[model samples]
Target chain A: MRRPGPLALTCCDPLAAVTNATARIILICSGKGGVGKTTLTANLGIALAQLGQRTVVLDADFGLRNLDLLLGLENRIIYTAQELLAGSCRLEQALVKHKQQPNLALMPAGNPRMLEWLTPEDMRTVANLVAERADYVLIDCPAGVEQGFKNAAAACHEAIVITTPEMSAVRDADRVIGLLNSQGIQPIQLVLNRVRPRMVANQEMMSVADVTDLLALPLLGLVVEDEQVIVSTNRGEPLTLNGNGSPAARAYHNVARRLRGEQVPLHDPTRERRGLRARLLNKLGMAGN
Target chain B: MALFEFLQRLLGRQKPSGTLAKERLQLVLAHDRSDLNPELLEQMRREILEVVQKYVEIDLEEGDVSLETEDRVTALVANLPIKRARPAALTAPSD
Candidate 1:
C-alpha cells in the first residue's frame, strides 16, 4: 500500500512533527519588560476560550513565570512542563484547568534552573503536544531578545508584539520586530497596549496610526489603560472574565474574534467619552435656549 | 505653577511630553538601528577629513560630517568647503 501523503497528516497523526500542521501557535513577545505580555496572554487565552476555541497557554518564561498567577492557577499547579517533558507526568496531568472556563487551561513553566535543559526544539516538541489537544496555543514569551525569547518563538508560526505608546517601548518593539523578521516569523501583529486617548488626542503620545506606520505590521488591537486590569490581577481573575464591560475587556474579546477571522471596526472606545461629553454640552445648550 | 505652564505653552517653549518622547526615541532608535555610536561616528569623521585634506585644503572652520537619516535609511554625509586646491603633484591623474 502507498504511504499516506503530507495532505493526509492531521493533528491526530502521532508522527506529526513539532509545530506541524496542527494548531495555530502564537507567541506573545515584547522586548521590554512590564509591557503586559503575560497579562495579555492570560486574558487572551480566556477570551479565545470564550469564543469557543479550546485554548492552551504555555508560560515560556521559565525563570519568572507569571501566567499561572495571572490565571489564578498558581496554587493549583500540580505538575509543570518540565515534569511532562521529562516523562515524569503525562501531558494531561500537567495541564491546570481553568476554574470558571472549561475550555481554557495552562501549562506552567519549569524551574528556572531547569531552563538550561529546555531548548527551542524542546519548546516546539512541548508546544506540539499541547497543540494536539487544543485549537490554539498561546506562548507567553519572556522579555528581551535572549535565549528565553528564542525558545518561546521557536515553536510558533506567528508572533504578536505588545508595546505601549512610550517611545522607549515602541523602539524596543521595532528592534524585536526586526529580530522576528530575521527569525522568519510571518504575519506578526502589533498590540498597542496602555494607550491613553487623552494623550493621543493632545498629540502628546503616538497614535495607533503612528505606531502602525513605524512598525508597518497589521494591528491586532489596541488595549486602553483600565483600572479594572489591576483589580482582576489582584483577584487572580482574568480581566476578560469579570471586566464588567471595560474597554480593555472588550478590546481583548474583539482581538480574539479578529483572530477567528471576524472583521471588527478599528475604533478606540476610550475616545467615545469625548463624544459623550460633547453631546451632553449640546443638550445643555439646547435646554438653556 | 499654572501661570508658569500657561506662559510656557503660550511661548511655544514647552513641548508636550509625548512629542519629546517620540523625538528622543526616533533619534536613539536611528543610532541603534545603524549600530553606529556617536564616538565611532566622530572617529570616522576625523579620518575622512584627514583623507580629504590630502587632496585639497579644506575649510575646517565650517566643514561638518553627520549621519543623516531619510525614512529608514542612514547615510554618512560629509560637507567640506575647499579653501584652496592641492599641489599638482598631490592631485595628479594616474596614467
Candidate 2:
C-alpha cells in the first residue's frame, strides 16, 4: 500500500492552521432567557457577514438549539457538532454555510443527549478548529450559570451580555456578569435589547445610560423594540438582511460595525422617528413658524 | 395635552418606576455580589446580636446590620449601641 503524502496529511488536519490563527471569539450570553441572545447572534452574524467578515455562529446551547432555526438553515444542517466530533464528517462539511451571505456560517448543536458528554475541552477544540477558517466565531450561550454556560464561555475570549430594561433581566444580567468576570473573561460589553425610548423619556422604562451604569460595562449597542423583528424572525430572515429601514436593523448593523473596530455612533430610533415626522410635515408645507 | 403634561409634572415627585427599580437593584445586587442573600443576612444579624448581647445589653430593634459598598468593596456594616456593660465577670478575659 502506498503511504499518503505529507501534503495530504496536513490538508486533512483541521488544527494545522490554528497555531497562527487570529479569530475573535465572542460568547453571547444572558443570565435570563428570552433576552434575545440567539436573535442578536443570528442578526449580528448576518451583519458581520455584510461587513465581509468570515463569521461562524456556534449554537453552544446543546439541549435546546435554535440558532439554525433563526438563521433559516435548520434543514440545511446535514452534519452537526456530534457528527463532527464523532469523526464522521470534516469541519467544513459540518458548517452550514449561508446561502445569500457567503461569509457567514453556523455550527449547530448536536443531539440533546450529547450535551452530557461535551466538555469545555471539546468546545475549545471545536472553536479552535473553526477559528482557523473563520475570522469571527460567535457562540450563543445558554442561560443561567451551568455546564452549558461554562462550555460556551470556555472557548470565547470576549463576551457580550444582553438584557432588557426590566429589573429582573438586569438583575440576572448582573449575576451573569459576576459569573463571567469570575471566569476571567475580559472586555465584556453589554447590549440593551428591546428598549422603548418613549417610555424611557417618560421615566417608565430604563434608559440606556441607566442599564450601562447598573451593569457597569461599556455599551456595545442598543436594539429598539420593533414589530419588524418579530416578523423577520418568524420569516427566518435576519432583520439586518430585511432592508426594511427598521431601527433594530440599523442598530444590529452598527453593532457589527463596532465589532470591526469602527466608530459608528449608536442609532437612536426615537430621534429618527421625530425627524421623519418633521420632514413629512415640511414636505406638506405645514409651517408652524 | 398641555393640561395633562402639567398634571404629570405636578405629580412627578413620586418615585418613577425605573428609579424604583434601580434603587431596588442597587441594594439587591450589592447583597448578591457579596453572596449574601436576605436569609443569610438575617441569620448573620441574629448570630451577631446573640454574641453582642453576652458582652453588653443592646436593643435589637434600634441596631442595624446591612451591606454597604464603597468603591466596589462590600462590607457588612453593623451598629449596635450598648445599653449597659456586662458584669465584670463576663468582661474579664480567661487566661
Candidate 3:
C-alpha cells in the first residue's frame, strides 16, 4: 500500500468534461426563411451518413419541425425531446430512425408549447447527448434573429450559413455572421444555395464567386436549383438519395466528403457553359448569350 | 387589348431566371432581415420623406431612400442630393 501511493490518484481520475472536449457540432442557420435550410439539413445529414459517419440531425426549430417532414420521418416520431427533458423519457427513446438508412436518425424537436420553456442550457445538454452518441451532429436552425435562433445556436461549435446570390440574402447573412462572431463563433462556412446558372451566363444574376466575395466566408457547399430538389422534397425524401448521378446529389456528396476532411474537387461544373461561346466567337471582349 | 399588352410587359418571359430570382430574393431577403416588412419599408420611406422635407427643399417626392442589403449587411441608402442652405438676405425685402 505504501509503495503504490502515487498510482492511486492517476489511474482512477475522471475524464475531462464533454463540454470542454473538441466535439464537432455543425449548425445550419439562415437569417431569411424559405431559402431551404430544412432541405439542406436533410440532404447534408444523408450525405454525411453516406460517408459512413453516424449522423444525427437535431431540428432546433421547436414550433415548426419541418425537418422530419422533409426527411419523410414525421410518422416515426415516438418521443419528442421535451419528454426526455422532462425526465419522462430517455435519450434513445426520443430518436426516430431513418426509413432505410440505418446509420442516420433524427431527434425531432419538442411540442410547440413545450419548447417555449427550453433554455439555452437545455440545448447544450441535448448537444452533449448527441456528441456522446453520434460521430457528427447537424443542427437545423430556425430563421431570423429571435428566441428560436438563440436556442438553436446555443450549443453549436461551428456554423454553416445558407444564402442565395441575391444581395438581400448576402446582406442578412453578413448580419447573422456578425451575430455569430459576437457569440464567440467565428470562421463560419457559407453554403450558396439555389444558384441559377443561366442567369449568370446572361449577366443577369450574381455568381458563386460574387456571393463568396461578399460573404468572405469559407465555401462549404454550392448547390444548384435542381428540379430534383423540388421533387425529392415533395416526396418527403432527401435529395442525396435521389440517384447519386445528379449534379445536386454530387454536390451534396462532395460537401459531405469535404466535411470529412477529404480533398474533394471543387469544380464549378457550370463554368463550362461560360466563355465557351466567346472563345468560339473569335474571343469577344465579354461573354454573353 | 391594352391591359393584355401591359400584362405582357409586366410578366415578360424575356427576363432571365437569375434576374427574376435575384429580384424576388432581394425583395424578400431585405424584408426577412432587420425584421422590416414591406409595409414597414413603405411607411419608413414616407416618414423619411416627410422628415427630410422639413430640413431640405427635396422635391417632396423626387428623392428616394430605401433599405438595401449587400453581402449580409443592411443599410439605409438614399439617393437624395446633399444640398446646402440658401444665403440669408442682408435686410428684409421691401413691401
Fnat per candidate, as a fraction, reads 0.42, 0.49, 0.35
Q: What is the TM-score of each candidate against the true structure?
A: 0.81, 0.81, 0.70
The clash count of every prediction, one per candidate, is 1, 0, 5
Tens-place lDDT digits, model 1, residues A110-219: 99997777788778877877886788999999998889998888889899999998877888888888788889998899898999876565445676776776667899
Q: In model 3, what is the error at residue B27, expressed in angstroms?
A: 15
Q: Predictions ranked by lDDT, top down?
A: 2, 1, 3
| Best of the two (1, 3) by DockQ | 1
- Which ranges of candidate 2 are over 4 A from the true structure? A1-20, A268-289, B1-9, B12-14, B43-63, B69-73, B77-95
Query: What lDDT is reached at residue B29 by model 2?
Result: 76
- Model 3: per-residue lDDT, tens digit, A40-138? 889989988877787889989897789999899998888877766665655567878787776788989988886658777777767766565578899
DockQ score of candidate 2?
Answer: 0.27
Query: Taking the tens digit of each residue's C-alpha lDDT, what string does model 2 give over B1-95?
Result: 24454244345434446667777887877888899778988999999998888788998789999897543467888999889988953656665
Lowest lDDT block of 10, candidate 1 chain A: A1-10
List, residue by residue over A157-216, the lDDT tens digit for candidate 2.
999999999999998998888888988999898899999866665445677777776788
Report per-candidate TM-score of chain A alone. 0.87, 0.88, 0.87
What DockQ does each listed candidate score? Answer: 0.25, 0.27, 0.18
